[model samples]
Target: MKRTVRNLLALTLVLAAGAAAKADEVLLQSAKSGLYVTVVNGTLAASAQDARQAVKLDTVRLEGNKIAFRDVRSGTYVRAGVGQGTMLATGSPHIRSWETFELDRTGRGEVALRSSQNGLYVRAGVGRGSHLAAVSERARDWETFRLVDVRNAGGHQDRPRPGQGNGNGNHNAGQGPDLSSLIGNYRITHVTADNGFLVPLGRELAGRARMSIEGRGNLSATAGCNSISARIAVENGRFQTRSQPMSTKMGCVIRGQSLVENRISQILTEARTVQRDGRIVTLRARNGAELLKLRRM
Candidate 1:
């Protein structure tokens, strides 16, 4: 019987019926308020209903809709109505690790290509790495998956650390709001300021700052010539940005080496509220302070 089941398990399948249910896993207890995570692939698994704090994630590395998480931590869950696009149409049938994710330990992950499919094909992350060779062209263009688990990637963390950066025995869990309304790319017009002043005095920023909504209840962004990372949270309709882990770069171009640093600090300090008023989404700081306005692009 086991042999029959083993034979029934074919590598061409993306996700099996029992994968989520039968996979080996450890219960994950979130540490911080909102689970801070990266999308290894642009495609997202799970559905709108499952986008709860128990299954929420963030993606800091992205340009437009093309994205992927660095890695989905073990037991890290996310429920998002997301999409995906193929980065490469050819060349050894490539599948970027960040573009694929799973929650089954024994499950085999692959990126199989099929005839008739061209361009970057996006898919759900549930069984992305698996069945890539044959399911590329036949799979749905987009699908909302509903399930959780990090599988046994061998790199997934056992669980959120305790007390290091707000991690405790119990995660700071909060029933976050539906962030889809708040989610969208915010074009950063100003690249922070300089030396306690406004406007940088050196070479303009390489990659401008950008904040986006990867899914409901989650916010992710980048800043400072692409040298910094931004992660935000929307719990109970209250928004909060995490402390930038990557410090602003030093050694400026004549406007003061600390110019960018100061600018980042100001932006960080001033940034608040993802407020919207009839198609105009404005991010302001404390009581209608100077805000950055954004629109659907």
Candidate 2:
């Protein structure tokens, strides 16, 4: 009886180990575009139709909550681009800093990958040729992905069903709010300085400050002085500018107007969360500090 019990206990341990190993195999699907991250011609792209075509990734857990993804078929690891290059490629045989990523999982079963090398979140660049890149500083919609278990992914579709949330706060299920809802003229109604930044907000600049969001992430704005232009990415009710905005070097003749311009420029670049309630759109920082409040025109 003792020998039979020992054999059964050992069998149980083996089954548990096998289940744990199978759980690590998954197919990463972009939450923003509903595309699977696949290797196409040795480059990482989010364009696969379903799990069958997606690259099978083995998640290797490491110390410090870091994980590395290895392509099961090619025996290669995913590497994030270094320096200013944001694209992610696959070909590394060993796990290094660039191949290491931290999974930031949302409560709704979605996850984002933060590269250990650049400390940036991996984003599915749907607008930029559907490529995967580690460029986003914040893990918003484009950075979020759904991990489908390979063992259970037979004919599995990663796209969220209609009326379901994609776990990124967008209710449309893999699609953000239509650009028409945000691509229009807006008049700055209110501005406030927070986190020790001082910007004198007066009544004179109420209607004078204007902003326009055009197609393809183009944003142009003015705050009673110099005009500012920059490219922005909007997803999951959040928006971030690519880089420092270009501003016309026009000196403000109005009192307190230059300070407002400086504040507006700073707000445009730092505001991460956007909320549209009817015709009013409020932009806020990550810490929930209100920055700019505008009315759609």
Candidate 3:
């Protein structure tokens, strides 16, 4: 009964549009090892275009290990071994692999690796040319992936790879630093141009602020300007903002305006990767260019 109610509530939240109940819509992104991997949000509410047409996507869900969106659309991409044939069987190595779906429309859907061993599927969109983007091997821990935000960068039909690397995705459950050491709210005082980040909010978002972090991959904050909300998706001891739903009132002027804008953008663009030294959690960017100081807010 409880599970049915929960499923109903989840669907209801996606259907209703008002003040958000919580950060319920999760967009699971697949990290490309050397390049950015694009994710197809879901089937468009409107018409389907050509091999390279823009599809207006609505909600997104992150298809990662440990977390699964049961109520979401059934097409989230997962990892699988490229076989000589097109069908995947039960209890295969690819069955245990997990990877995000690419942008393609040729029935490359996201499904459970726990059930199938078929290679990853991508829905077509607007990708030109033939790029051999394959997930022959499973994703490992701390393995970096980038989102290609370039113009007309996403959309392509993927082919199968028969013989690939040994399929053992990176595992970090029992390795690395402790989770508690990095849990706290920090202030993003500055940023570096080498940070390779696009400001999520604004450059004017600056000033006295607090960003509270929890061990369960959750983050909440006050922009020193307004109440800011965002979900923290942590991987490999690093965090990036997901669905940064904010309640900031646009009522600032002059320097106050700058404070609101700067702080909000900084917090969003500020991808936090903390280095722990006892009780002090020194949060830094991925490139070590910009660093932040978080306390128990």
CA RMSD for every model?
18.0, 16.8, 17.5
> Which segments of model 1 are wrong by more than 4 Å?
1-178, 190-207, 216-224, 235-237, 242-245, 248-265
Superposing every Cα of model 3 onto the true structure, what RMSD results? Answer: 17.5
lDDT of 1 by residue, 13-123 (tens): 213211323333322211211122222112221211112212222222222222222122222222221223333111111123323333212122222112222332333
RMSD score of candidate 1 (Å): 18.0
TM-score (all chains, Cα) for each model: 0.29, 0.44, 0.31
Estimate, for each residue in 203-255, the C-alpha lDDT of model 3 and write its tens digit. 44444555676877566666455566666665555656777556667665445
> Sort by TM-score, best first: what order?
2, 3, 1
lDDT for position 111 in model 3: 22
Worst 10 residues of 2 by lDDT: 164-173
**Residue-by-residue lDDT tens digits, candidate 2, 222-271:** 87788988888778676788868888989888786677777778888777
TM-score of 2: 0.44
How badly does each model clash, as a count of residue pairs? 27, 0, 36
Measured by lDDT, the strongest candidate is: 2
- Please name the candidate that would achieve the greatest TM-score relative to the true structure: 2
lDDT of 3 at 252: 52
